[model samples]
Target: MSRRWLSAVVGSLLALLLVPIAQAADTNLGDLSLSSSNWAEDSGNFPGIWDLTQGDMTISFTYDGNGLVDASGAHAWAELGVRSLHSGGFNFNPNSRYTYNTTTFDLRAEGSSTDVGDVTVSSDETNIYVKFVVNSGSNCTIARTRVQAGSSVSGFPRTWWGDAVPSRFNHQTIHSPQVIEYVYTISRSEVGDGDVYVAANAQIYCDTQRNPRSRIVRTCIDAWAGGVPFSRIGDTRYAIYDSSATRVDGSGVWFASDYDWTAGTFGPDPAGSPSLDIDDKFTISRFGGHAEGDYNLPQTPPDPWNNTHFWFDRDDVDQWQAAMWGMAPGVSYNTNGIYHVVITLHATSATAGTAYMTVNGASQGFYSNGWKDAEPEIYPAGMTFTGDMQQLQVFYGLLGYGATHSVTFSDITIGQ
Candidate 1:
């Protein structure tokens, strides 16, 4: 009623509005932390949980007690759709679904969403989907801001059920009362220090198979008491293995391509007559680079264990020479390496390519054999990459042919 009293009330409201809103603390939700009465309402069955930590992400499913299915344990799957999630603390559901097939533990992103980079998922436990987004793990400056929900067929979007029964799976089966968890991890770099929202969904299928006939059990978003806090990472989100000390643990030779290099061994050991000798090539002991084909020698070496050193014995080869040829399908010579002997390949086209070799990290320039018109006289047999290429390879060589006289190669890496 009075001007003075009205002004005082307005001032108090303004002060409250200006105060910063409190954020949730970071928490680890391992071993069914969501299967508690405190997480859900005092009366209802706990639904599922979507949790994010500094370097880990997870989705969990628990009985919410809405009583959608019986307790014999049906095959269940969980999905988390990005509605609005990023390092900036804003969520916008753009109808995108990041689906996790619980049984197979396969993670896929659909709905034309384009916010982050390639994401790979794997699982050791059946109930949970644990994954790591490779690009997000490597680059911290990049951020992942996604929405909580999407308009996709994968999660079976529903709208009828209310609070008592939010969503229901199409088919029902017997599932015991246990916490089913799906987990994934991204680099702190991908998560930065921001708020992210994931639209959570789960499915229950009969006959122990996952398909369209499966029922939709739950569809919702992740919520926390304090909210998931991403603590600031002072250093890089990922580790670097470039230096010798860092990569000294690395062992074995990396064959450029599986098609040319004989199985069980790398290219022919430094040959004197420039002829391929399958027996003289490097041995296949440890699993390092991706293998595309089988090897010539079937003998399996004892587990390489700490036998991490690669032996590249070129002393026997009076000369290093190669004939240029096009690369085979599903194969390319990756020119990313760091080492005492570095090989750089440039493909001008599908049929033509050139190569340059280096030793001790110095520029040996292109092969000394010289280029011949469109065809190169001496190109790496496995050379396949084209355009501004940088690879890492390390070489330790002794100049002899006896079993004792071989180049030891170890520590292979690609530039970031």
Candidate 2:
């Protein structure tokens, strides 16, 4: 007899003794779906699908249609597999096998069943927290976990904060059924009011080469503590006239003029003497002793033009006290509270000329002519002010009487 004919006769005899095979129907277990149709003998072309959908997460499985039968005719099997995917993607091989009984055949699921569990989010006044539970199953272990935060949900790493794997739980083996809690604190300055979105993921390794990730699960929390309110009282970048010494806002907070060096020897010059340049920068040209430009607080008294070189009166100490304590002119200044004063400028001098800035009586000299960003002078908690204070003063002068000196200031800002 022919080999094909003999094989067919053997298959017919076995079929007569075995129970009838039933048609494959779609099966649903929790969030997983095993979908297929029409069971038949090994045809070398059968394809099945296994789909898993959880909260905001979906995974697709592809069957390779390569079935293997036992040499002793005891069982037959096929595998539902996954293609290589990125982080926060899923991987698994759900083996569908049929074992022969005395008169019937049974199909069942076997092998690794790794998956991601519940992902929860919470927040307080100062921080936002996230937790991820990974069910690694008995055969596999978790390799890594990652978390990210953003303004919205759908855009992924584009809108997500902390970069591509921001908060990583790595370098350790997490066995079956363990929960990994990840907490990331986004400062109040980085987040705004309303909902804040977050996403979490976990990767599992079944063996040496098979490593698949769970689908990215995303959620949001309505946790946004309001940020510190800052009232800007001065900025040279806007609303300042090109050639005028005083600010256009009429606050009298910015002036480029000379201050009195000695009694009746040199007095405060006109507001236009060391006026603003065409670039809207405060410029102080060559001038006599104690030529200075200043950003003064509101209600400051006129220069006494005395030989003592004091800007504010010693008797009315409250004005001096407020300026030293980060009190901008119009805003309600916080005493010893957080405040920022930033300045950016450059200076040039001929012969022995010099340019320096004095803030709250502390002096920092500028050495280079290139644009420099003076470190933001911040007055944080627990600061005490003493002695005579020069609040944001820029002084330019020459050592030898006749040499020339020039100073330009820009981007001066005061906030509280």
Residues 1-416 of candidate 2: C-alpha lDDT, one tens digit per residue = 99999999999999888977774442221111122222322111112221111111111121111111112212222211121111011111111111111111111111222223334454433444444433334233334445445454333342133223323422123334533333345443433334654444445433222335654333211111112111133110101001111111100011222211332211223443422111111111122111222212121113312111112211112344444432332222211111112222221111111222232222222212332233222211011111111111221111111112122222222211
TM-score of each: 0.19, 0.18
Q: CA lDDT of each candidate?
A: 0.23, 0.25
What would the TM-score be for candidate 1 when compared with the true structure? 0.19
Clashing pairs in 2: 89-213
- Tens-place lDDT digits, model 1, residues 317-397: 222222222211111111111223344333344222333333332221112243332332222222222111111112111
Candidate 2: worst 10 consecutive residues by lDDT? Answer: 235-244
Q: What lDDT is reached at residue 370 by model 1?
A: 38
Give the best candidate by TM-score.
1
Of the candidates shown, which would achieve the greatest lDDT relative to the real structure?
2
Candidate 1 local Cα displacement, residue 131, angstroms: 9.8
Q: In model 1, where do residues sit more than 4 Å from their true spots?
A: 1-127, 130-253, 256-339, 343-381, 385-414
**Candidate 1: what lDDT?**
0.23
